[model samples]
Target chain A: MSLGCELSDLQLDALRELMNIGFGQAAAALSEVIDLRVILTVPKILVLKPEEVPAFIDAEVEMPSSFSMVEQFFFGHFEGTSFLLLPEEEGRKLASLFGAEAAPLPPELETGSLERETVVEIGNIIIGACVGKIAEILKDQVAFQAPRFIEAPVDRSSLERRLAGAKDLALVFKTVFHFERQDVFGFLFLVASEGSLEWMRAAVDEYLGSLA
Target chain B: MGFKVLIVDDSMVARLAIKGIVKDSVDSLAEASSGEAALDLLAGGREPDLVFLDLTMPGMGGIEALKAIRSGHPSVKVAVVTADIQARTLAEVRACGAYEVIRKPADRAAVLALVSRARGEGAAP
Candidate 1:
């Protein structure tokens, strides 16, 4: 285990297998939506205390600017935060897909009914698939809220302030998504409450038992 | 006649953003979740006056779609609407013959303004 919390060899293997299944499902959903064969590299899973979270990603990516989506969800097994990172150029490219001639700034989305529907839908599918898979792995049911599109650059101070209020350790898993010959990279962090971590330990023990 | 539009992005949200920007100027809206889907929509005989595309996806990405549309539907105007704003990405959009590029998290006014320009209602520069 990357975090100080240790699991038995059997438990670790079981947990890894479960995560693999979840990631696989996410890959399939993405492939279907994009109409292309999406290859999701095996996720790099690690457990980290809050202080170690920054080292997990590109330092400059701290304030992920550009058109992006953030979703937070919780299931019985775990609670997760997912960031769908699109390159700034990719955002412009998407606008062109709808017929825009100039580069659209963050202030430009309020113009149509259909674009609103479409943006929410896209966010739903990507985040839903990723989290749903994790839920399945843990054999827990998952539910989701409507997508909240962040139209502005995220303020790092605000994000840090929110994280500071959390009651448990955070685990960071970075997954790279390559779609339709383009690279769309994203990051996912699973935050476990202190109580949830205790539950996780028991669940891990049970899963490991099943594997053995 | 109002223009016909094509929206391409793996994110349903991005596609919706494009539709929001262009709906006022366009008559009908068609969607493709990926580069291949965009090509498929065109291949099925839908001639879009304009296309909004995302650069990064799982399979057929924006560049490939641009090439396909250029060869297959040369008359269609394509714009790159994505968050990948790296210089190389923009250069690729230029090479692909994209009419323009729009950044992500597009606001209502920007959407309206850009679509107006794409339709030649506003000066593109």
Candidate 2:
């Protein structure tokens, strides 16, 4: 069943607020790191079948020929993968903000390229801050895997294959990031595993109850 | 009699959370979803003794709102409620004339204490 079917309006609202606070903290963290004002859109929560994510991303980003993606896994009461996606041009702009040079590298050395390193660092800071704050608010503990940078064209099939490990449903939390200085924009997608759905609902209720 | 309080934030949940904490302690409560809305409430003559404002919002954010309230309604105390607890942010709000800054996911006792303090202070003269 869909999250909308399972969660009431108030519950959804609570979830949205939680994400807002989480992303607010993330923005602050990124701001301090980059010394730029980071503006984040309110996070949109959607329950989509795993296969639908690629189409959603394609529609959102207009399916650039190639994009930079950083994939990281978080585990806890809320467990899932988080992806930070930026178009190649935007990624280059972000890398330049970090003073990364655009020297050409051979395929073998591309894995350790400075641009890839810069993007991964940005992804780690954003994901860690957002997930950490959410967990802190829920009073849950989480651990994260190393972020992996993917520099390749992300087609529907490729993305679907990557999501093959996800269960029947994925709870996707999407937000856009705007870095004021460079006017760089990126998309952050947190795909919660099916296992976390029940816990998520319960946690939100518990939080609301505490407030009451 | 108790003091009137205004809870301002873009998130309905946040406003409700603060409201739940201080509703019984205060005489009256008002809610605003944005800084501009909060300013409008004050401009329209809703004179709350204390205003709990959130910093980040769509338009006329907490800082600008705080400055306007300080200039227009000097007696109205404002407490910034935000998740952005950076030193710079806190210092900026204080410099802008916020009486206090309450971190988001606010603690109930802290909120109560702030309300109690506001009541005592507002009650004076």
Clashing pairs in 2: none
**Highest DockQ scorer:** 2
**Superposition error at B62 for model 2 (Å):** 3.0
Model 1 CA deviation exceeding 4 Å by range? A1-4, A7-16, A59-67, A80-123, B1-125
Please estimate how well model 1 matches the true structure, expressed as its whole-model Cα lDDT: 0.60
Candidate RMSDs in order? 17.9, 3.7
Candidate 1 docking DockQ: 0.01
Model 2 CA deviation exceeding 4 Å by range: A62-65, A100-112, B121-125
Fnat per candidate: 0.00, 0.37
lDDT of 2 by residue, B9-90 (tens): 8888888899989989999999999988998899999889999998777778778899999999999999999877666677
True contacts kept of 1: 0.00
